[model samples]
Target chain A: MTLTATSPAPAPAPAGPAPDLAALAARHGLVESGARPCLPEYTRRLWGRRHFVTAFATARLTAQYSRARLGQLWQVMTPLLNATVYYFVFGVLLRTKEGVRDFVPFLVTGVFVWTFTSSTVLAGTRALTGNLGLVRALHFPRAALPVAYAVQQLQQLLFSMAALTVILCCCGQFPRPSWLLALPALGLQATFNTGLALVMARLASRTPDIAQLMPFALRTWMYVSGVMWSVSHAVRGDKMPHLVAVALEWNPAALYIDLTRFALIDSFAAGQLPPYAWAGAAGWALLAGVGGFVFFWQAEETYGRG
Target chain B: MADAYDARTPTVIADDVHITYRVHSGRTAREVHAVKGVTFVAHKGEAIGLIGSNGSGKSTLLKAVAGLIRPARGRVYTRGQPSLLGVNAALMNDLTGERNVVLGGLAMGMTRRQVRERYQRIVDFSGIDDKGDFSTLPMRTYSSGMAARLRFSIAAARSHDVLMIDEALATGDAAFQRRSKARIAELRATAGTVFLVSHHHRTVTETCDRALWLEAGTLRMDGPAADVVAAYEAHAKAKK
Candidate 1:
């Protein structure tokens, strides 16, 4: 295979002078960037690639329903189907809806809100592992994957939220001034979901087994989160242990769900709301949002490596 | 090409770089040291061929240079963001080839307008759109070779400061290979450095000006393309 040894391997041409790499980099606007980008820079890069995030999310969402018989209808139908099943199992069979006014709407609201968190968290686990090929082949912010998944779920949730509004009206809960509050409630929930998704993506990308165990974990969380039944009613008059009851009441998921129910369900009263529901929502969002971002960013460079 | 080898024009430098990967054998975990202390300087307009046996860390070295992996020790410095040629690796098989082109372009840091303007050229380069609506079909429907060609085409659309190609040309036909060779030459002419990893001695000798021969995670030879390739072919024949 040798080319007739026509020219001896031209020895490396003499290196004229040692170049100052730092100065050279400065002159060329280059940096040693193989390491994890700093947080501020990463955020800036992420912002710069915001279009990619939305584009990716839209692509995934469209493809997700591409093969389904019901097509995009399944996005709204999946949650409504779950709401029905939960209404049967918990509301009718267990009579878990006892003492809860506008029980159907309450159950629907909880189901929709909880789905936002559970779906995002589960999808986040697969964000990196599912796109390992992309991660390996492309150079971009790894956070884009999880964030895109979260956005996809948010898109899906927006569809389900429309369904929730119809369910609310049919159940005699008309649009009230308080109904306006679901906006901030969803905003907080979305922020919280994004953070949790980031954290879960990092963990699941490393272990992978976390994906298998996530469903069971999320199921338990759903029970405690009052997805189908009121946490307040479940623990009312010391029916459950004091500490467990308090934990359920203050659970971030439960708090967000309760806030939505208070806003949308006519029977749900603001007085029954947790004293610091708004504070709790903001705190959880900040804790998960800021903390998860840092947590995920700290190991940014480690992602997609074998 | 006057100052192509000038030290001041160093386009890529790997400083005693090492890469180790954690692998599991059954239930036992172990670390495989893929690249051990490889140090080299590539100048502007250089076409470097990385030749090695299977698992000799040719791909790993390229990946480390592309910033896909942080080496266990030492560091790699590149002139700019290096685009590894398997951009199709990032393509979603479920999506149509057309969508993959757009997504792949965005991922490669091309603006929307750039991708839009070059869409026809990319499709022409890949030859997938010659038949009506073929690019609209899902990538999973395409053969592996077609997919590789498409990826190469998309990546080659943009001139990169540092480009790493891993066995991309091995899948294409003679005509495609010739076109790719010309593309690499053109890239180097534009002062872009390219690292080609391939086991095809003929391909390496023809496409690259210099060659690095790796054996079992170490650089066994580094010299002109023909010299290192001849030594490598002889070593393989002897082993056989």
Candidate 2:
């Protein structure tokens, strides 16, 4: 207990029953941990450095795949090509009648939306471990990391969707009536994916083995969500397909994808959704987002340790 | 320009800091107390060496000081930052060493352009001299020494108000060690507080004005470097 500037800072002292951190210092061995920054203080510090986060995101976006020649080009190309493969496989070969007219466009819309949801969650799962240095050395919102990934995903999604819009227009089936509904649908997807990202990332941090099974999880999700196949046949009379559709539709990711289809296929006014479904998706998003955050903050103390 | 600071204010106050890590093995979690009942104060312009043998909890204590770990039973107060050199640390493996410098600087709270402005010095400090594949070769390729040099250059590139260094500095050679020592001295001279964790008693005594000894997550001793280091060395050697 050698005296080294033991004088306390002359800041407005707290009056409320904020726990006396100093009193417990000896018992806790926190004699050196004087005034730890809380969430609000740290957030303001990080926010004041918003340009820093943006720069970090930009660097990550650019360098994440710098080794490849096509690099970011694949961000757009991969989705289009995926859409094309599904279009030919499901639309041409399966020769399924369009549940809605212009099935090629419909299939394309579904694949891209679903792709964003799956990929964002998969990549964001390692948001903490992948940037362990940044989290440990620098104090930034850990949420900012996954949010950055989402932002990066959103940027690419926005760009790719523009091209998607052009292709849809070229197909000469501009979804004017119901398309506006897709905005809320996309919002729902982003929110829900963010939530799942939190849960999975937290789980993965505790269990490294969890990351290995992500591919299998995503594949299972794809099938259940009714992305490539239509649920119309099942919805008519088959209890099995109806059961599967309801189960799949219960997933907010599927809800978002289905809404994208409705937005693109349903005419502007025709595509508008019943408030109940959107509200349902909204609830799922809230659960995933808030639940993920609490779960993450619970382990905030564990980060940066051996 | 004159410095404007509240001179009377204590920058750091850690009372009864207890950190425990649950060591996992085959589904069983054992509580390995990393730092137990540690109480210490760090003021501005102080150079403190956190010295301990392996499992002595020096690293864990340093981490707790940096606000990276949540003490299981205690509280920590830091005026602004009581964090390790790269507490939220890593050198981006895929990016070039130069890019790492920029990232490390920004992560330490320097602005983007500030990092870029000091780019040349960072590169020189890292001691990469026109090596081919410098940009293309992934950081995983660099030897541990080269990698440490790069990380240290980026981390040590900026002057921190309160900087904590783990055993990370041990990799560099004697010359680099001297340069590193000088940099830390400069930091202390300019009212910066440094907490260094090192097992090498010589390095700790040479670099820090004060030393702390931790044992199984508890503070055993804290005082002048020579006295503390001598006691720690004898105890360590005797145990061996």
Top candidate when judged by TM-score against the true structure: 1
Clashes of 2: 46
Which candidate gets the maximum lDDT versus the true structure? 1
Clashing pairs in 1: none
Give the Cα error of residue A84 in candidate 1, in Å.
1.5
Model 1 per-residue lDDT tens digits across residues A255-294? 9999998888877888777789999999999999999899
Q: What is the fnat value (0 to 1) for candidate 2?
A: 0.26
- Across the candidates, what are chain A's individual TM-scores? 0.90, 0.78
| TM-score of B-chain for each predicted structure, in order | 0.90, 0.85
TM-score of each: 0.91, 0.78
* lDDT of each residue in B1-240, candidate 2, tens digit only: 001222334466665666777666876878877766776666666778887767888776666666777777666666655556662254566666666666667666777788778888877766754466464466757777778877777777766657777766645778777776777667556545778888777878887888887766666777888888887777777778
